[model samples]
Every structure is written in C-alpha cells, then in structure tokens.
Target: MSHSVASPSPKLSSWTHTIGASLEPWINLTRVSRFAGTMLVFWPYAWSLTMTARSANLPVARFFYLLFCGFIGASLSHSAGCVWNDILDRDFDRQVERTKGRPIAAGKISVPSAVAFLWAHLGIMLWMVRDVNSLAFKIALVTMFPLAGLYPLMKRITYWPQAWLGISMNAGVLMAWAFITGSIPASAFVLMGGTWAWTIWYDTIYACQDKKDDVKAGVKSTALLFGNSIKLVLALFASLMMSALVVVGRLNGHDLPYFLLSVVGGSIYLAVQLYAVDTDSPKSCWAAFHRNGFNLGALIWAGFLADYIWAAQGPALVDFARGVAVGW
Candidate 1:
C-alpha cells in the first residue's frame, strides 16, 4: 500500500549546501582562543582611549566612540588575518594535532570561499579605521599589508615569528592614542614597547603547544629554538614589559604608588606563569598560555587606577569606584 505513492524527499540545492559548509569554517575561524587573543590586543586601545578622554575631561560618550571604532577595525582586521593564515598554513596545520580539525585543514572549506571572506573583512576594517583617525588608518594599513603577507613565512624561516607578530599586535597602541588625541604622545612609545614584549612573551608560550608537531613538520618557532631556555627568555621579556610600564607611568607623572602597583601586579602575575609552568607538559603549557589573560587584566587594572590617581592628584584607590563607574 505504501509503495503506491512513494515520493523522494526534497534535496538541498547546491547553493544551500555551499552555504552550510561555508558557515562551519567561519565559525571555526572565530575560535575561543582567537577571540580571547583579539580581546587582549584591543583592551589596551580601550584603556588608552579612556585615559585620553579623562585627560581631556570629555564625557563617556566620546570615549565610547573611540572604543567602538577601535574594536570594529581591530576585530575585522583580525578576522581577515585568521582566514588568510588558515589558507596559507593549511598543509602545515594538518600535521599539528590542535590545528588538524580546523575547517580549512579538514577540507570542509574551499580556498576561494576563505579568500572571499578575507577580502570582505579587510574592506570593513578599512572603513572602520577611516572613521577613527587618518593616522590610525595609516598605521592599520601598514600593519595589515606587511603582516598578512609575511606572517606565514615566519614559520618557514624564523624561530621568532612570535616576536615579529608582536610588532603587529602592539601597533594598536599607537593607533588608539593617535586616533583619540590626533597626535602621538611620549606615552605611546612606552605603551607600545610594553605591549610588544608582553605579546611576544605570551605567544612564545602558546607556540610551545605546537613545538613537537612544528619540528616534525619542518616549521620553526621560538619554542623549538629556545629549547630548554624558554623560561629564561620569557622572564627577561616580562621584565622588559614591566620596566616599560614603569617608565611610562613616570613620564605621565603618575604617583610612585601607581608605578609600584603595576610593577608588583605584573611581577606577581608573571611569577605565577613562570614558576608553575612545566614546558615538557603540553597540558601545563596550554594552561600557562591561557593564564596570560589574567596577567593582562592585572596590567589594565593597574593602569586604570594609576591614571585615575593622577587625575585626582590623590591616593590611587580614592576614586577607584567612581573612575570605574564612569568608564575611566
């Protein structure tokens, strides 16, 4: 009886199937680790914008605008970079355990689709930075073009690709300060330097995860090059970051307590990372990599408190609650 009117179920069109496959790649591209890394990079810009706004005595709305523009540009730029990296490193990615499941490496995504996504994100980033400041837009352009083209080559040639990547990440400090103030201040160099060291140091830790696979794949990274001496390198890099923070705080005329607070906070955070990390254990190394978020948070909080203290010309904690409430 059932065979009398048998009919086939409707099949999805080619376009529908294409779109379904495309979505998974985009979703995978926006991994949690990627999101966290992006957020950490953008946080300095947000913090700097708030400081500039407070220094000018502007309302929270103006500060929010700077933050909005910076976030949009940075996020779009990061999206493009991620897609491009996946495309370029697809073959190498398949050799690494953590990266093996990525959409591009898994063959779930087409290279043409990834390229289209990259171009779209780049266009959006360009538009966003244009609205912020010409100087920032220029910086974004400089950072994007060279970094995007050359970053993939790092794995092929240099063990310190993370250091080169640091330059790209910390360029945000200059972009943010110039966008808000319309000029590069002395503070910009100090902050940028600190950000650079911090990024390189943390990224080195992250690279540890891929060290074994990377070596097997004939790729280079600091994790392999530094070998057993990574801890020493990380400690030195972290020290440089803290030193930069101290110098910047002083130049901005922050109280001694402000400088001390940041140094101590950063040091404690770094100690937790350096002391507890077991480079031989991939699990421990991954944990250490994730802990950088806390380190960054400490630095941000210290900077915010210091800036508020300078503005109030009083104890750092005096206006802590009020400063936080007003987005300072």
Candidate 2:
C-alpha cells in the first residue's frame, strides 16, 4: 500500500486566535501613555522649534524635505524603541505587578517572537532614515544600540537609569539637528541636553508607580531608591530642569521676555506637579507622570512662540509648509 502525502490545512482559526491573543494585551490602551512619553522623549517639538529659526529666504523645497523626513524618522525611532523596550523587559516585567499583565510578560507573545518583532520594528526605523546623512545615520545606529541592549538592564543596577533613558530618547534630537545642519552646534546640544534632563525628571515620576513592586523584584529605580525623599528629589530635578531651560534661552540670545514668559509658565506647571505629588500613591504618580506631557508640549511651544515674537511676525505663517519643505 502506498501512503499518500498529506497537505496541511490553512489553520485559519488557530492563526486568528494566536494573533488575537498576542495583540489583546498590547491594546491595553493604558499603555498609550507610556508610548506618548516615549514620543515626547524624541523631542519632535524641539525639532519644530528649531525649524522656526531657519531663515525665511531659504528654499522651501529643502526645508520641507528635512522637516517631514526628520519628524517622521524621529517618530519611528521613538515607537520602535518603545516596542523593543517592552519586549526586552518582558521577563523582568512579570515580577512587577504593574507590568505582569503586559502581553509579552503574560506569555501572549513568546520570547522569541517578541525578539523577532523588536528587530523588525528597529529594522523599519533603520529603513526610514536610510536617506539621512551618513553621520546622522551612524549616530542613530549608536543611539538605538543602548535602547535595545543596556537600557533594559539599567533598572537592575541603577537608581538613575532614567538618565540613560533620557539620553537615548534625546539622541534623535541631536541626530536630526546634525542631519539638517551638518554640524552639532552648541545651541542644539544645549537645547537637546535640557530636553534630556526634562525627560529624566518626568520618567522618574513615572517609575514611582512601580517602586514597591520594583523593590520587591530587586530592581533599582529612582522611585524605590529615593524612598521617603522622592518628593524632595522631584523638586530638585524640577528646579534643575528650569535652570537648564533658562540657560538654553540665554545661549540662544533670547530676550528677557522670552525667558520670563517661558520660565513663568514652566514654574507654574512645576508648582502644580509639586503640590499634588504623592510618591507612595501609584495613582498620584501616574497623574504626575502624565502631566509631563503637557510640560513638554508647553516648553516647545514657549520656545517657538518666543522666536516668533522676536523675529518680527515670524517668516509669513503661510510659508511655513513651503519653508519646511525646502530646508529653511
């Protein structure tokens, strides 16, 4: 008797189930806050602010080319990094209450599958920026290395991992500026540095929510490490963030009004953060962390608005799109 070879069925049901299981926890939606935090870290707002500094006489074609490309690339990098971070931290995540239900941590995605997905996301980021300057490309590559590798381990050993996280997040700002201008100026460095510090301060507040679980799991974090002093720590960092912003304004030769208005807005926001912050309360920590998004948007707007005010009607708002297109 000859045995007939059997062909495999499509297994559509199994495939659909598998995909649904894998995607459901990722769609938790509360995670969107984390993603937003990641996006802000890329400082796309800062890039837009810098574009406002470009001369109006510059060709619109090049400005928009740079603007669109820079914005999209930074966004992709931000998303890819966030996804990859979730993947890498999956194992450790299960040990923490807040993260235990995440898709990867819950075994909805197997470790190998999560790893492949991370690489794929990062690959997309690479392809997105392929046409950028060689120097910028190299910087981007180096920047992502830490995100995929060392960043996950940071919580294992340091209370200040948020500092490194900020560096990774701000790397896009530096790379984009260099890609457009072909050189790293003191102004870009200073502004990006300020943005980085701002990220650290805010992310620390975020980490505060997980402090108890993190300590139980033997993970180091600013929240867990600071313990009873987290409020004071937050105040210190917030003050430093404002000081850095003031330095940025001075470095850019912004007028006193620019500094006063921006700093006043920032101070008011910071005061709000300080007044209601409660390190031991996870709900309060989440609220405080989300407030940073507003701060990020406000700070960027402050800088851009100041530039507009000082530049005498600011390069014809109608030409904004055209100017961005041509590298103004």
lDDT of 2 at 130: 84
Candidate 1 lDDT over residue span 221-307, tens digit each: 888888888899889999998888777776666655555566676778787878988887888877776667555555755655556
Best by lDDT: 1
lDDT of each: 0.74, 0.67
Residue 288 displacement in candidate 2 (angstroms): 1.6
| CA error at residue 276 for candidate 2, angstroms | 1.6
CA lDDT for candidate 2: 0.67
The list of candidate 2 runs beyond 4 A from truth reads: 1-22, 26-35, 44-71, 255-257, 305-328
